[model samples]
Target: MWGRRRKHRPKEYFIFGTIQEEDRVIRINPSLDQPFVPLWFLRYVLYHEMLHSVVPDETVSGGRRRVHTEEFNRRERDFPSYCRARRWEEENLARFLR
Candidate 1:
């Protein structure tokens, strides 16, 4: 599955990458070039980004995207390595941002 920044977004589509809601941009990490990463992990990130579509507060306030709300965090933990994955992403986003 690919998540491209389309010229026109369809009514309903599942995105598997980070989406810049303000700009309607969808960015896929090339480092994830290989799809061998666990589906759970991939899904975790996708859903994480999808949350932005609903969380308007992330933009109005000058704060980090609360990818993990108290309930989101509690529920996301069930995905396994949720914390670890987030930490890994934080530590390695620089290498993967390209």
Candidate 2:
């Protein structure tokens, strides 16, 4: 599922993508569809969402559910472009916020 891009205010937090375990749906932010958005970064987002299907969430103190557990993080880092994708996001996030 490709989600429509919403207008985001500057300095606000944004979700690049998400996965719904129950519905088995992975929704990607349409902002990434731009020509300037690198394919590796897009693949990274899809990979992150796909991981949610395989990695189970963890229950922590106060009964809180942690989706990105230590194990999940470890697996996420396995992606070849993980570091580059992160750096790209950090440097270019403001462009997408528009």
Candidate 3:
């Protein structure tokens, strides 16, 4: 992920990573590239984005795309440090917000 200037905003929402399915490209938020950020946490975010490639999105009613399907979440939890990674995110989210 490449760093770029962004407008300051509240910490109400944040996206750790994303994937462009058509281009098969993954983009992680540059905020996660900090000294305090753990490598395992970074890997977890990457794994989540990579999962998008294998787990198909579900087409819900009205044709809305459901990116994180039940199957996707199930597989995500299969990650070795899923719980720990999530806990770390919750604890360290404020760092990225700044």
Give the winner by TM-score. Answer: 2
How does each model score on lDDT? 0.58, 0.88, 0.86
Pairs that clash in candidate 3: none
User: Highest lDDT, which number?
Assistant: 2
TM-score of structure candidate 2 = 0.88
Of 1 and 2, the candidate ahead on lDDT is 2
RMSD (CA, Å), candidate 1 to true, equals: 8.5
Q: Which stretches of candidate 2 lie over 4 Å from their true place?
A: 7-11
Task: Name model 1 segments beyond 4 Å from true.
Answer: 1-16, 20-26, 58-81, 87-98
Superior by TM-score: candidate 1 or candidate 2: 2
Candidate 3 lDDT, tens digit per residue, 16-71?
88888788688888777778889999899999999999999999999999999999
Rank list by TM-score: 2, 3, 1
Better of 1 and 3 by lDDT: 3
Candidate 1 lDDT tens digits, 1-98: 35544555434433347777677565654445565555556666876666556644332267556554566555656666678777766664554433
